[model samples]
Each structure stands twice: as structure tokens, then as C-alpha cells.
Target: MRGCLLDAGYTPDGVRALLGRSAHDALTRGEPEPAARASRDGDELGTLVRLFLLEDTEPEPAVTAALGDLDPLLAGRILRRTPEGIRAALDVRPYGEGPGDDGEPGADWWVVSDLDSPASRQDREHVTGVGGASLSLAAATVRRPVGSLLDLGTGCGVQALHGSRHAVNVVATDVLPRALALARLSCGLSGVDVDLREGPWFAPVEGERFDQIVSNPPFVPGPERVDYVYRDSGLAGDAALASLLGGLADRLNPGGIAQLLGSWLHVRGEDWPDRVRSWLPDGVDAWVLQREVVDPAMHVGTWQRDAGLVPSSPAARGQAAAWLDWMAAERVEGVGFGFLMLRRTDSTPTVVVEDLPGELGEGLAREMTGWLDRIDWLRAHERDADLLGATLLIAPETVLESASSVDPDGGWSELSTTVRRWGGPGWEHPVDGPAAALLAGCRGHLPLSELVALLSYAHDVPADALVAAALPAVREFVRHGLLLPVDGWPHPVAHRVAAADPAGPVG
Candidate 1:
């Protein structure tokens, strides 16, 4: 059956192409699977699509032929013989493997979840299959080899399935029994083993520590109660997210990393960074990248739309108004959605808050881990004397660009210089003459002190004075990942420079 689905073009890109762009867009928006049956009616692919995706009844023979069996499916409640024809008991769709997941290319696994909003009977206990948030969290996870991983709120066990590639053991937890049951089926079908447990966050794994933890929890910020278990906790706005983050320190081993997707309230008159920072424990380094923010009105509307409620509906206006009023009463300025990467480090913790509205690309896990390692190096070597002896190299993705002013006398004068990075944080740093020279010359061949000494000789300046003038830029470059140690440079230094201005170094 899996082979049949793959051969019939049911993969992620394949389904989009088969449905055409517009219909694909509609399906993602919780609309019915439009044009699927119209385009491939009465065929094997169409029969499978109708039965699983569209939630439409098909002739008993067609479904049986596509599945190759009826007794097993019926016994499992995956298929039911209705008076009209054959109906699907669950939503089993083809989930494409992510870039770094432990699976072969072009592999598709059957993800089992409760029927979605469009096809659902408005059940509050919907266990989502592969949705946008699930995919986003999967992409953002730092995939390192680990002894164990905890997939908190593992609705369909997608994160556990992804983590099982590198982890020796994966423990998946869910609050809802149905979710855990379906997740077990999902893992079984994918040929993955998971320790499935039923409980609220952190309870099932009490007193347990993991090398990594991941979650795409019910983070939608709303009133104290909501019907949907998959997208909302009974707690008030953003508390679910805060609670999850607050519990990280106890659950993580030293140097363990946790990545999760969440929505937090942007309260009025409060610094959002500080708000998020308060949730982090004292021993963890964190990077909270805010991807999107929506006003209170828009936030409520988004959730309503996900529940298939439109503003035009009579009840929706009151619900929207009530939600907005409640948010205002709670002093919510806005709602922010993002990914949080937390690592339990023994050193003084560092928290970086930034905005990244762009879509995440592949290899983020490796990149995130590398960025954290660089931060460790920066904190450890904060002195010029310690940095001066280190061999430095410009990062590969860095590019140097300059602009000059044409003087009134027709002479060119350099105006400004900048170094742009492409691969990691995508930061562009302004550079001066000394910094530009450092980038051009520091190709991992010589120590920074030697490189500065050569520059001093070329410019007819004393080596000590040149080193003093260049220390600031050197520190800035290293902090931003533009400069790096080439060989053994981690030894303690006897002398230290007081400070380094990141603006640029004077030479």
C-alpha cells in the first residue's frame, strides 16, 4: 500500500502538483480536498485520496482493491462498510520525511490522526496528524546524536519518529489517550519504536532527564477554557507555554537541548524579551526567535478560522469580541509565535532574543548547535591577550562589500565597509579599515597577533599599539562568528584587554 501510494504520486510535492496549486492551498487552509476526486476519479490514487483525504465514501470494491484487504482494516476500525459504500474511520495520510529524519528519500509514512477540521464532526479531541506547526518544530530541532529524547505532547509521535534517528531511546508523552493510541499506530507503521506514555507534560517522565526534549504543544493563547485539546490548554493565555518553558531546567541534563514551538502573549508595557526570559531557568542558555506577531483581534480570528468559524457567522462576532475584550483585560498587546532553543549550560546563561520572519531552511539543527558552540567560545575568551594568540579565519559564507564616495575633486574616498554572512544568523556587520584587513588576511594560516604584527609593519606602527587599536574589531568579529580559532588556542592568557567596541576597531 505504501509503495502504491508512492508510485501514484502521493508525496508532499506530488500531492500539491496533482491537486494543482490553488486546491493545495485550500486544503492547507482546512478547506475540503477540492479537485482531488475530479482530477483522478475512479482510479487507485483517487480512491485512496477520497477514502483517506477527502473523507468521501467510495465503492466497496475500489477501497478494498486499493488497500488489498477489508477484514483487517475493518477489524482495526480503519475502514467501515457503510450503507452507501465504504467510509474511512480514521485519517491516514502520507507524511513525507523531513530533510534530516532517519528515512530514505521519497519515503512516505502513513500518519494516523483524528479527522481534521474540514472533514471532522467538530470533535473537541482532535489529534492532528502532520500540520504546519509540527513540520516547523521538526525543522527547527537541533538533531544531534543523543542517548535519549523526550517528545512532550507527542500528538502523533512525529517528533519522536524524527528523533529516533539519532537517539538510542525515544519517550513520547501525550495527555489524551486517543492521541497516544494513534501515535503508537503511527510509530508502528513507520517501523519506529517509541515508549508511549499517557499523561500531562513532564508527569509521565517524572524525575527523568533526557539529552534532548522537543514539543509542539497546545500553545494557542486564548481564554481560560477552550474546546480543542490539540491547540489549547484549559489554562489562561500563554500560561501553557510559560509552564512548559519553566519546567525545562529540571528535565534537561547538563548540556541537554530543548526545542519547542510556542505562542506567547505580548503584554502591554512589558519588554517581550524580558517576558520570555523570565520563563528560562537560571542555568540554561536560550535563543528565542520571534517569527510572527498578531494583534489580539487577529489572534482570535486566526484560531476561529482554524475552527472553521468565520466572522460572518452570528456566534463568531460575539466570540471574537469576547476574546478581544478578555485579551485587552489581560493587557495583551499582541501574540507572538516562534521557536525556542534552550541548552542547559553550567556557565552564566546567555539569552538572545531576535526576530526572524523568514521561513526556516534545511540543516537548522546543525546550524543551531554550531551557533551555541560559538557562543560558548566567545564567553570563555573575552580578553584581547587570550584572543590575540588565536589563529582566526573568516567564515566561508561571509562576503565583503564596500562603497565609496566620489569627491567633488573627482577623487574616490571609501565611505563604508560591511561584512555579510549568509549561512547562519544572516547578520551583516559593518567593518572599518583594520577589520577589513583582518578579514582579508586571517585565512587560518597565522595567529591574530602575528597577523596584526605584519599589519603594523606594513603601516609603520608599533606592534603593541596596532594590537590595541585592533582588539575591539577582533573581539567583535569573533563574537559574530566572522573570526575563529584555527588550532590549539584555548590556554589561559596572562594579560587581558578591558573592553572591545563592536562598532569597529581604530587602526
Candidate 2:
């Protein structure tokens, strides 16, 4: 590799001149030969050599063009010149491999081979810092208007790097010092200054609260260890993630939001959402989106394979034993995966629980924004529109007060449909099961969105899924007068208010 650099018309000083100061120092410190380094299994030196010794790079002219003339954070090079090429470079481990096709074939040049030789980028085997969760949580953050931010268990510093752009001051914590060192280099290269600390959750940030806290903590509950320790936060059950949620209320600024991506053990015959709901601290308004569920066997099979535990390491045998033990001990049938959006306040608790039926990254931004908007709607709106709309639009078919009386305190009661055979003296029968339960309630009274929400809750399905599955039925119900649709929902009062305040919050 050294000779190659020299042959590529590059010398130590030339390489140093190419990169700024800090990067030069980082690179020149000590590196191994690419072949010798790649040969070693445990030594991290090989990984560094592979990442830093990039000579053939696909030019990012399009990316540069898209970035368009933004002034560089650093005038020329970030650091001073050195004998080595670059110091403290912001490197990407990728930890993944596959057909590198992402529209811009140009980007593939940046990733010639699978950079994530250690693990795949889409590696979802470990618990806390999985690919989708980490990147999504980092991406979903509303970067503007945050004063300070904290990232707990900031594996690879992806969260810290993202936060560094939006936050005035950012602090990242991890139990592993090596991870912190890696994160420091990453932040240095990204030109994002962050205070790096080493400690467990709350230990590092004691007596300190931020406007925002985002975590993709170790969330898996099983006992199997993987090559990368970055993903595992050691709690037996969902205890690690649950405790984080229960404890974060007091650690956040008033009206501050803390977004998390995690997994929870799904005990058979138990309501997963209800179990998870018990974890949120009071005075913290929360929106829970349950995206995916993996049964015990599938979970083990998938994670174990990704870790090279099975075919390579006899992971099949070891994982089978460990997972069986965990399942037997915890009586856990599966693991539920999702995202949590929470805000701490002094007011009464407001919880919105919905099945997301997907991965943490899918439509996560829209879901989070909708959650924030719903919180605003809840705080401002008083009388339930369902009741009003029922009375006015579907008066004959709607049981105006009966629906209201069904649940004295209801957040959003779903419409239940019970098929009618001609005319019966009393309501013929009540429906059952997920499908029956969700389809029974419309009675033509509520707005389509609210009705969809009700069905989504009842079926334990996603909002989008609920709409997709039930909209046709809903249109049928409307045609038959069993369901009613109202347009004046969500209060166009905002639109009117914005008439004068033209470039208002709403677009």
C-alpha cells in the first residue's frame, strides 16, 4: 500500500498536503499493509488501512454539483499538513455489501466494493444500533431550532454526526471507549464539533438535559454476542430500552422531543402496545409506531446468520441453544420492533398508540411530523368532532350518544360494523376478530381520517394499511348510508387564520 501510494505519484508529504491537518495526523499515525491487515481477524488496524487507503474513488461531481457552492466549513483543509496523508479522516465502515445500485451510479464509485466488510449496511442482526433504526432516527430529526442534543450509545457516531449540524452543542456518550474514539474521528472529518464522553445512559449526562435526545440503543434481549459490540446494550429483556423511555421524561427540557428506535420482547398472549405503553413516563406525550414483528425462531435465524454465526461459526447450534434458553426464561415468543416519538411536559399524559406495520425507516419522518401535529390538535381541540359530525351528518344511522357513551373517556374510538339483514328490532350482532372488529364501527358518523385511525387501532394494523384495506369498504358504507364523510375536519380555521399570514406554518 505504501509503495502503491508512492507509485500513484503520491508521497507522505504529498498525501499530507492533500488532506488537512487532523486527518493527516490520524492517517499517518500507524497503518498496516492492506493485504496483511485484511488477513487479521481481530486487529482493527486492517479496517483502518482499508478505509483510509482509497486511491481509486468515483468522482462525486454530481454530488458536488447538487451541494452547489455552499461555503466550506473549513477555508482550505481542516487541519495542518503532515508527513502522513490525512489525519483524523471522517471514514465510513459501511459494514455491508450488496449490489451497490442507488440511482446515482456515480455514488457507487464512492463505494466500489462492500465497505462494510465487518457487517452489511442493512445488517439488522444486533439489537440497538441496527442499520435502518440508526440511519432513520438520525434522518428523521427536525434539525432546526434545537439548542442542545444528546445521543446515547452513539455507535459509529451516526447520530452525533447528524445532530452536529443542527445543534448548538452536541454531546455523545457510549460505554465503549473505542467506539467513542471512532466517533471522535468521524465527527472531526465531518467538521462537526461534539463533546465526546464515556459512560452509560444518564451517567454521562447526569444533571444535564438537552432540548433533544436521540438514541438507537442496544435493544435486543437475547444472550448471543456478535462480532461487533456496538449494537448490544446489556439488559435481559426490553429493560434497556424501556428504562430509557421511562427515565427520559425528567431529562428533557420542557416541550422537548426525544426520538428512539428500539425493539421489545413480545410475550405471547399479551398486548404488546399496552406492555410498551406502561414504560413511558407520565407527562411525556408519546406516539408509538409498531413496525415489524419477528417470531423467536425467525429472529434467531436472521440475526445469527448476519453475524456469520451459523454457517461460519456453528452459530446455528450456539444460537439455537441461547435463543431457546432466552425464550424459555422470558416466555418471549417474538420481538416487536418500532420507533418512539416522545415529548416531555408538565401536563397530563397523552399517549397515541398505533401499529406501524413496517420498518422504523419507512415513512418515519411523516409519522413523526404527524405525531407532533396531532399533539397540537389534541391540546387545542375540545369537543370531539365525531359526536358533532354524527349528530349532523349521519343522524339517522349514527348512534350519536351511544358511541360516545361506549367509552366515557376515549381518545379515538373506531367505527365497528355489524352487518344488518334487512331490519331487526335490536342490533343483530357484534363483530369479532381483527377484521370484524375494525370494520364494525363506522355508522357513517366520523371523518374518514378518524375512522381510518379507529380501524387501524382495532385491527392492530398501520394507518396506511388501514386506509388501504378499509377505504373501499368505507366508500361502500358511505354509498349505503352506513358511513358518513365530513370535509370540515382538522379545522380549516388554520387556513383562514393563514389567509393574512400567508407564508405561515402550513404550506
- Global lDDT scores for all candidate models: 0.75, 0.53
lDDT of 2 by residue, 1-507 (tens): 222223332322333334445544453342324333232341222223233343212123321232223234123221122354223122332221111112211100010112232344334322222254554564455544489999988866767766655578889998877567666655654456789999888898899888999888777767644444555565567777888898898889998889888888889788888999998888888878676788888776776655545433664676577767878778888888877888987767678666653233223443354346544543443234332232113314323221222455856565553543222111122333543443444343445466557766766788776656654443333333333233423422221110000010000
Q: Model 1 lDDT vs. the true structure?
A: 0.75
Best by lDDT: 1
> Cα deviation in Å at residue 31, candidate 2?
26
Taking every candidate in turn, the Cα RMSD to the unseen true structure, in Å, is: 8.1, 15.2
Q: Candidate 2 — worst ten consecutive residues by lDDT sum?
A: 498-507
Residue-level lDDT of model 1, residues 368-437, one tens digit each, is: 6656766777676667777776777777777888889998889898888898776646666787776678
- Per-residue lDDT of 252 in model 1: 94
* Alpha carbon lDDT at 138, candidate 2: 49
Q: List TM-scores for all candidates, in order.
A: 0.82, 0.56
The parts of candidate 2 lying over 4 Å away from their true place are 1-115, 118-130, 224-228, 358-362, 385-507
TM-score of predicted structure 1: 0.82
